[model samples]
Target: MKIKRRAMLESTGLNMTPMIDVVFQLIVFLMLATDFTNTEIERVYLPKADAAQADDHPDKTRLMANIIHRISTESDCPQLKYKNGVLLQPCQIENHWKIVVRGEEIKTQERLEELLTIEGNLDREVPGNPKTPSNKPVMIRADGSAPFHLITRVLEAAGKALVWKLEIGAEKPPE
Candidate 1:
């Protein structure tokens, strides 16, 4: 007896619509998350610390003030490091530096203090108590070659604002 040949199976393609949607969703989520976190930080070359501790648990409500030196002219001896694609150089001139907070450049010390004061006024630990300082933490991220006086000015501003919780940013020395 002659056996009948089996019918050939039809090839099916993958339903990629759902997969593509999922991938796009993930991309959007990651972009949003990255923007929120990075908006608060400014890239600056930090000083090397012998005993620097990693910020494993960063507070979400923490405030950051970044001291950036606007590199004007090429230096004879550059810092030889790059942070956020900007070349780090030794800038001793006070005018070449500026303070940035929450993506806004603080042009004057008065303006810096004013902004910090507003920040300090919110979320008081002891409600309705004027003496109670703000619970929010503030951090100063200064470039390695930044002038000490500028950092001091930031400290004075924080003190004036009554935000006591403060931190200085530093990086571990290269091994």
Candidate 2:
């Protein structure tokens, strides 16, 4: 008995409409899920400065310290506290201040020390020559209405942490 075999059939072109639809859906989902706000620091009307400059190169690595007012709680709001030491719980009263380092509040001077020490020890050495890392610019974003004492405390804490280079975030006045 002889078996008959048919030749391979020519295939139609692929349809990219479904794939494009999926891609678009994924893009929309990601855009919605990802937050564009700078969550590291809360929104505040920054004080105006004549010499205030936008950070031209925003990709540089640096530690951000935020001095923000206390959260106001209304009718048992949710809160977040994790191993990273971040606290997002509502405060008993508004206008309370906090010093946060790497998403965690600065409870003590030692926490700041630990953060700096870890950053310094992270892949920054040149082979066998372990030298003091150049001062990492510590950016401080404080509310314009934030008390002057709070700013001073943050500065003093930064000094204690041995971070010399500092950048204070401010808004430019309207022309």
User: Which candidate number has the best TM-score?
Assistant: 1
Q: Write the per-residue lDDT of candidate 1 for residues 37-149, one digit (tens) a residue.
A: 65777777788787888877888777889998765577632444455645455666667788989989888889999988877877577766545787778889998878898
Regions more than 4 Å wrong, model 2: 1-38, 75-95, 120-133
What is the Cα root-mean-square deviation between model 2 and the actual structure? 10.3
* Poorest stretch of ten by lDDT in candidate 1: 76-85
Cα shift from native, residue 27, model 1 (Å): 8.0
Shift in Å, residue 154, candidate 2: 2.5
Quote the RMSD, in angstroms, for model 1: 5.9
Query: Top model by lDDT, which number?
Result: 1
Model 1, residue pairs in steric clash? none
For 38-74, candidate 2 gives per-residue lDDT tens digits of 5566655456687998787753456777776555555
